[model samples]
Each structure stands twice: as C-alpha cells, then as structure tokens.
Target: MSKEDTSLRFRQFEADDAPVVYSFCLQLIFKQSCWQLRKKTMLNRGWMISAVTASVLLAIGLSWPVTLITSLLCTYLLIWISHTAYSYYLRHNRYQDLCSTAAFVARWCSGGQDRLFVATLEDGTVIASSGIVHQDIDTCELVRVATEESYQRKGVGRALMKYVLRQSTSFGYKTVVLKTSDVQTEAQRLYETSGFSLSKIYTVGRGIMTVYYYKLNLTDH
Candidate 1:
C-alpha cells in the first residue's frame, strides 16, 4: 500500500453522508446518461438519413448554397432532438426515480441487508463510497460506487471497493454483482482488475442504452 492509501480510513455510511452520496450518484448518472445519449444520436439512423437527403438534394442540381443551408438546418434539428431526448431521459429514468430524494437514498443505503461504506480522510471528509445490497440468499449486488472527482486516480476508489468486498464476505454472500453502463469504461476496467467478470449485457431506453452486469465469486477470491 502507498502512503496515501494508508492515510485513508474506511467506515460504514452515516446519516450525514446520505446527501453527499446522493449527490455523487446523481453526478455520475447525469454524466453517463449525457454521454450515452450523445453517442446514440450521432450513430443513429437520423444522422445517416440527414446525410442522404443532403446528397440527394445536391445530386438533383440544387445550388451549393441551398445544399449547405439545408445540411446546416438538419444539423441544428438533430442537436435539438438530442437535447430534448436527454431532458426526457433525465425526467423519467429509473436512476432519477431511485435517487429522487436524499431521504430515499439514505433509507435505501442503510435499510435491511443493504450496506454502504465510505472512505474518508483524517478529517472525516468522504472521498469515496460503495454499497452492497441483498440480491438473494447467496448473492449481493454492489451499487453506487463513486469517488470525488478531485480525489480520483488515487487509491480511494480501490480501497473502498476492497472494503465493500470484505463486508460482503463477512455477510456470507457467495457472489457479488454490479451493473455499470457502457459509458463507464474506467469503472469497467476497475471491476475487471478487481476480479469481476462480465456475466451479462442488456439494453434499456428503447435499446439506446447498454448496461453491463459483472459478477465476482467470493468463494474463489
């Protein structure tokens, strides 16, 4: 362990940490949702149709100025559509529903068999958090793993993950599972390095969003 890792401490989630954790979860969801929507818009058939229409107009002997203007208008329309879709997603997505209130998030994190862990500095500032929730008798789901942006690239996230896994084992879970979206490449890498294997892939939002499910068998670890 590095000196920075040694300076970090891990503890269970407290009531005061609810607001911070909820904010962190919201930030991550918003960022991932925006990226996913933007990428989908760029790759969707709408852009291809726009290009084909512009080409056909030019081929039909329209003036260069007209073709250019039409293409620019198409581009603006697509941008507006993307923005509208993102707004609608933010309003109706399940993530927003689950994180709708700090009180709800607090109850979810600490209720029943769910457990949330946080990594803090000596001064009690939470830099990272990870949660384990009951999935079944022998399985647990990992959720809401997040790190402060300024404190990322350090060992904070990894340490928090380790703590969560330890707690999962202590709770007699045989497997640990987590779901992350396709846009979270860094998080995917972290989970892979930590011994989680990709077990399933599914799409939501009318197939515009891709979600990956990863699992770690604690018995093998």
Candidate 2:
C-alpha cells in the first residue's frame, strides 16, 4: 500500500479514537457529577496500590537505583492522578453550567419532533431555568426536571411540567413519571399541584438522598 493510503487509514483510526475518548470523558464527568451532588467521595486507594506496582516494574528496567526511579515514577503517577481529578472537576463544573438550562430551548432551536423539549433565554444567556424531560411508554412519562437556582420559585418549573404533559397528551401518551428528592418539599408540592401522584421511595447512592417517584395520568387531555 502507498504511504499516503496508510497515513489516511491512521487518521481515520485516530478520529474513531477521539469519539471513544469523548465518550469515556463524558461518562466520567457524569459519574463525578453524581458523586459531587451526593457528597460521595470515591475512595481511590486501589489506584495508589496499582501505581506502586507499576513503579516497581518500571524501576527494574531502569539502570538507575531502584529506590530513586521508583520514587520518581510514583511521584509522577500521583501528579498525573491529581491533574486528572482536577480536570474532571473543571469539566463537570463547566458542563453543569452550560447544560443547566431550559432543555426545551434545544428542541425548539433544532425544531426537533422528538419527545424532548428545550428552550433558552433571549440574551444568549442560557436560563438554566426550569426544564422538562419526557419519555413515552404507555403514555408520556415525566422522566426528569431540573432548573437553575436563580430561576426557581417563579413557575418556570410548572410551565415546563405542563408543557411536557401537554406534549405527551398530544402524542397520545397515557402517563407521566418523575422522581424527586424528598428534601425538596417545595418541588414535591409543585408536582402534586400539577396532578402527579406519589408512587414509591427510592434510595440512590450513599442512601442519604430519598427520592420519591410520581406519576400523572393524561386522561382529560
């Protein structure tokens, strides 16, 4: 094969690698976000144990004294770990800021016909305000809802809730589902007022946050 052809194949391989890396990064960000939100610290003692083993193996191949090389490599590994943790911190924080908004704006902008609805503010500032997420099973299921702190208590959340329910009704979905933290009393009240009935309690990570699932039936619409 020609060198140019080989190079082109290598570039394609690299492009595929980029998406895999992005997916891994996004997964880590999500895990870290949940950990952060729940105040759960991921104890990583095994990484240190594994790093020590790696350093010992590397030092054996080095001409330098084993202690010196092992120490240096171990230090380097620790530094890299710290750097990775800090990068994850920055990435999730930034992503939370960017995605914290009216998700319907995205749907509106994309003219998406899918069950999701998203919206943004007028000033190019993402309202991060209240937003709704829905899934159609036998009916429209309110999968999730989130709103930025600054935009809460003003009915943006209720509006999104109603919007999703209306969309579900139009789509011929019979039910909507959602789960909320028990600590969020106001949110629970809002959901009840919107015609949602409590279903069950769920315990997530750390078992500290109690989540209550609610369902709303769309018979009238």
Candidate 3:
C-alpha cells in the first residue's frame, strides 16, 4: 500500500522516454540501493576519513584520561558497527539490483511477449514500475518491481502488482514467482496479502542475508 492518497496513471514504459523514465530509474535504483546514501554519509571514503579524524581528535582533546580512552573506544566501536551494517546493506541491495535488472532485461525486454509497465502521477511523473519475464514453459517471473519511496503504501505498488498478476494469468502462465529480501518486509507482506505463498527462503552472500521466494498459482486465481 502506498502512503500517498493521490491516484496514479498507468502506462507502458518507453525506452525512448529516457529523459524522465530512465533518469528516474537510475536515481531510484541507486537511491533505494543506498548507493547515494553511502556516497554522502560516513559510509563514503572521504566522509569516513573525516569522521574518524574528528572522533579521534575529540577523544584526544578530552580533559580526563579515562573519559578520553572510553570515548575513543566507543568511537571505534560505533564506526565498526556502522561500517559493518552499511557493508551488509550495500552488499544485499547492490547484488539484488544488479541481478534483478539483468534478469528483467533478459526475460522481459528480450521477448516481445513480455510485459513492462510504469505508474505515473497526476502531474506526469513516473513513480512506480514493474516487469515480468518468462521463466519456463509454464512459469513467469516477476522482476524489477519498484515504487518511489514517497509514494509507497498508497496504491502504486499494489496497482502494478495486480496488473502484472492479471496479465500473467491472461498470458498463459501457470505460476508467477518473485524474490524478496528479508529487509523488504513490507514488500513481502504485500506479496503474501496478494495470495503469494512462501516457496523457500535461502541464504546468500554469507549467513547474514536471506532471500525469500514467493509463488502464486494463477490457475487458482
């Protein structure tokens, strides 16, 4: 469900609409992946160096030795925790975005029968998008589903999902499957609400990450 109440317009995505659609895609893709956040915050090399230097100076400038030492230890501990968490976040998001985009292109754009759709705002901004690709003779894979952060929970995602599911059924697919990460709890909830059942949950890129597979039988719909 989207957080916005405004109704959105639905349309087919155009490769030629590069100025808006493609540009938005790039920003949203990287932003949602934390690429931009990492670049601007302590997760970045430059900011990281500055933050560490500032922390060390602050600790050293403290009047009390015990306080200074404890502050230094805390600062290092905080940096380590932040770095580790950001590393995990970037790892999962980057891997998923790259793989999802590749699969979407191969399975959806490569085939004339495959479908891609985008949601636009009343002001003509493309804010949400999704695409589906053929996985096998009877299975279709849902990929590249994304809704702008501000527009989430309002209906952009729900509308896109509903359209894709209906299209998949009409296109002769027996089952529709998609991958969602443990971090995407809201997305998983939506999928479950839409009748998708958890088929499997698998760990990837060390035990710190988990990916869920959800499948919906179109024939039952």
Q: In lDDT terms, which candidate is top?
A: 1
Whole-model lDDT values for every prediction: 0.78, 0.49, 0.66
* Cα lDDT over the full model 2: 0.49
- Per-prediction backbone clash count: 0, 11, 9
Q: TM-scores, in order shown?
A: 0.79, 0.45, 0.63
Candidate 3 lDDT by residue in tens digits, 1-221: 45344466776666543344444455454455344333333333444555555667666674555555665455556555664576556536753333344533443344476677788877777887877877887998887677766777777788778877887887889999998776567778889998999999998544334789999999897
lDDT of 1 by residue, 100-210 (tens): 556545566546898778988889988788888798999999987888887877778887898889889999999999998777888999899999999999997666668
Candidate 1 minimal-lDDT segment of 10 residues: 95-104
- Candidate 2 minimal-lDDT segment of 10 residues: 4-13
- TM-score, cand. 2: 0.45
| Model 1 regions more than 4 Å off | 1-4, 44-46, 52-93, 96-101, 104-106, 205-207
Q: Could you tell me how far off, in angstroms, the CA of residue 13 lies in candidate 1 after the best superposition?
A: 1.6
Per-residue lDDT, model 1, residue 141, is: 93
lDDT for predicted candidate 3 compared with the true structure = 0.66
Residue pairs in steric clash, candidate 1?
none
lDDT of 2 at 125: 28
Write candidate 2's Cα lDDT for 1-221 as tens digits.
12112111101012222233233324433443344432322233434544565567766775446655565556555545654665466555644322323322333234433433332344322222222344645644453254444555666556656656766676667877777665567768988998888989878544544779888778943
